[model samples]
Target: MTILLYDLVGRDTARPFSPHCWKAAMALAHKGLDISTVPTRFLEVPTVEGGVSKLVPVIRDGEKVVADSFAIALYLDEAYPERPTLFSGDGGKAMARFIERWSQLTIHPYVTTAAIMDLHAMQDEANAAYFRQNREQRFGKRLEEVMAARDAGLGAFRASLEPLRSTLAYQPFIGGQSPLFADYIVFGALQWARIASPFRLLDDSDVVAQWFERCLDLHDGLGRKVAAAAAAAA
Candidate 1:
């Protein structure tokens, strides 16, 4: 079956900036599944797949429809066991849930907070206002106010990634010899920032940067091609 992935896109459709959407994309890639993507704008997502999901990364695999990146990851893993494993075992699966939560609660906030302005710039006027209003409500402050501490923001964000840095220093990926859903959980956020902003999250000498480069090379350079290709235009 040809899977259809409704991917969240900004003004530039080539830059699918939603970390959640990228997670689904990478999962589908890991499963060796061929997918056709529809570039969806923020305001357009509420009607995706006939309003079944008010989110992007919603996938339709033949007659089955799935929403939420993590749910879709599990679905791909189970449905195509012969392709390759997303999770190594039950323990790995459980570990992935923890990683997902950590990425959401910790890493995602820093990345989004730092790149709020960059994200705002990528949207058209209508979408930008919509984004500003919604995010301001969430942050209880204006976008400029939220991103005012960007200098300190980068330090804090990098510090939050210490555990991952320490781990990657010893192993090539969170999955040791191979990349796993846990790896993708964090990579998705990294890719999000990469696409939405010119801010460099990791230092050139950082071990995490090295690992990130490895991830950039995976699936025939799928992750790198998606966002970095749009960097010039952005």
Candidate 2:
């Protein structure tokens, strides 16, 4: 049976911009599983699979419905042992956990500030209003005000990626030779920024940017299929 992925999108259903959704999508691709995506808007998320979760990146495989991108990846790996492994073993799983936390703590805040308004712009009017209000309440500032400081934080953001840069210098991927779930974890984060914002988050000469380009070319250009906001507009 084809997996049914409830992927988050904004006004453009073709653009599934949620980082978590991208993680699940990439994991499914890595596992060589067939999938059909259900483009879910913010407001429509609560209605998916009868309120499976407050968040998206939900997948239904046969009779088993799974929520959360990490859980979905775990499920896919266990269920399809014959297919390509997401985490090569227990050690990889442990490393993936660390990388996930590092990406969230070190990478997410910067990208959120950099792309929050662009994310709002992609939403429909209703969702945009909700996003603006909710995010403003969370951040204690308007979306524009939040994004305005992105330029100042750019250097710190780049510096925070030194560990990843060091790793990429030694190997082509986070998974060494082959891309793994760890690669997808970071890829999903940057891919969110790429799809939502025109901001240049990384310098062209940065190894992190080069690594991302390599990731974009994986799964037969899966990440590249959704053009960046600037490219999409062009």
Candidate 3:
């Protein structure tokens, strides 16, 4: 059976390489699953219209539609049980689940904010225009309004980093020595934030920085894919 992933190739605002999606993609890649990506602009339209819901990183295996990143990860794990398991046996699986929840509820917002600020700083005019056009297309509102909403979202985003900072202090990976499903989810969001935007929040945090580097190393091939996408976008 073919695995189809709905993804965004590069810096498209509507279908940005969200961590949630990244987690599923990386997991599938790591498992050596037969996968193909179908690029989409905004998740909500394809999800709702296509019956996948507003959730990104939807994985379709034949007629089986797996929505939600975490759910998709679990499905992939069941489909392809292999070495380098995304989740350890029992306890590890529980921990992985917790990390996934934490990343979504806490870490993602701050990383996203930092990324946006970073992107704005590096390529303000171009990025702004890109964001405006994308937002207008997806949200159907004035660019200014979207920007204002983004600005307001920053406070919560900043707050999200604290849990990650604390979590990383103890473990190399989110779940422990080996990266589990949780790491992939968090990494995707962090990577998107760092890559699409310009923020280097990882710069100051030694543990988080090291962890991020490790994640890049783990999915070196996917990194190349992302680089190629960025180049193509450029």
Per-prediction backbone clash count: 0, 0, 8
- Could you tell me which 10 consecutive residues in candidate 2 have the lowest summed lDDT? 225-234
TM-score for candidate 3, residues paired by index: 0.71
lDDT rank order = 2, 1, 3
Segments of candidate 3 deviating more than 4 angstroms:
9-16, 47-49, 115-171, 228-234
TM-score of 2: 0.97
Judge candidate 2 at residue 207 and give its lDDT.
88
What is the C-alpha RMSD, rounded to one decimal, of candidate 3?
5.8
lDDT of 3 by residue, 1-234 (tens): 668887654444433466667888888877777787776554233543366566577878887888888788778777777646777676767777877777766766455334543443333355456655764677566644444546556555655566776877777877677778777877886777755654345444456667777887785557434531232233
- Best-matching candidate per TM-score: 2
Residue 176: error of model 3 in Å?
2.4
For all candidates in order, the CA lDDT equals 0.87, 0.93, 0.64
By lDDT, the better pick of 1 and 2 is: 2
Best by lDDT: 2
Q: TM-score for each prediction?
A: 0.95, 0.97, 0.71
Error of 2 at 31 (Å): 0.6
Looking at model 3, report the run of 10 residues with the lowest lDDT sum.
224-233
Clashing pairs in 3: 19-188, 19-189, 109-157, 110-157, 118-198, 118-199, 119-197, 119-198
Per-residue lDDT of model 1, residues 23-116, tens digit only: 8999999888999999988899888878988677899999999999999999998889898899999999999999999999988888887789
Model 3 residue-pair collision total: 8
